[model samples]
Target: MTLQYIQDKEGKTTGVIIPIKEWQSLKEKYSELQEEVEPSTELMSWQKKILDERISDYFDDPENVGDFERTLDDIEKSL
Candidate 1:
């Protein structure tokens, strides 16, 4: 693989340029090299139970839930 350096007006190296094919190949290989992790069965069971309870509680008092879309819009505006 050959790398070409991009220079600024003063000839100072600021970035690099590589062939598109080489870049795509590198990206593909790096993606394949990522580690895969399996969630623990015990922890997943506990999380599922908690989520189910929350859903049940929400249904028990549907009027108590705030406007989800408005809440999300407010959050995005704040960010």
Candidate 2:
């Protein structure tokens, strides 16, 4: 599975070249990765908390809450 890189004037790789057999083997191996990889639990939890707080704060304004809820409801209904 030998691979070679073509570099540019800046010495950065511009492209890669692999044998057909090696490319075929790589394709077969990659095809086995059929599942969506979930993010780490801690990261996901932190993201959820941050999003929830942002949403909560955005809706805390009386005028904005009505528009936000209406927009959210419309989006949910469309979904």
Candidate 3:
């Protein structure tokens, strides 16, 4: 990978210049790096609470967690 640095008038490094082909290849390889739309304020708060509660429950009783293989078999049967 090659990198070109952009400098200010004072010769201080400010930005980078990437070749178009290299940039395109990087974009394809890391498509998920694209900007994401954030959830609404209310939805974000609700999701945080739900996730916190789930983590707490899991830690409170790790033994009570569902069996992975059995859960998959049950799901397949339902389908």
Candidate 4:
């Protein structure tokens, strides 16, 4: 697992950064860490179609594809 640390000027580790998937996993393991917010698990049909297309694209060229963040940024830019 890759994590980034936010450090203070004196080099003290202030906080740790993790991927969203890992955060969700942590929330599942520890009840105390969970919040009241519950995100929807269901994807709309259009969302599912887009995901399927992206999965197909990924399988076609696994090495050349952008990571989720970059892809999301590109999408947001287009929007």
**Against the true structure, what is each candidate's TM-score?**
0.39, 0.36, 0.44, 0.40
- Indicate whether candidate 3 or candidate 4 has the larger lDDT: 4
Model 1 residue runs over 4 Å out of place are 1-43
Better of 1 and 2 by lDDT: 1
Supply the TM-score for candidate 2: 0.36
Q: How many residue pairs clash in each candidate?
A: 0, 0, 0, 0
Residue by residue across 1-79, what tens digits does model 4's lDDT show? Answer: 7799999999999999999999889889987777555666889999999999999998998897668999899999999
Clashing pairs in 1: none
Runs in model 4 deviating more than 4 A are: 35-79
Residue lDDT tens for model 1, 1-79 = 9999999999999999989889778767877533333344565778989999989999999888888899999999999
Q: Mark the 10 consecutive residues where model 2 has the least summed lDDT.
A: 32-41
Any idea what lDDT model 2 has?
0.77
Positional deviation of residue 44's Cα in model 2 after best superposition, in angstroms: 35
lDDT of each: 0.82, 0.77, 0.83, 0.89
Q: Give the TM-score of candidate 3.
A: 0.44
Candidates 2 and 4 compared: the better one by TM-score is 4
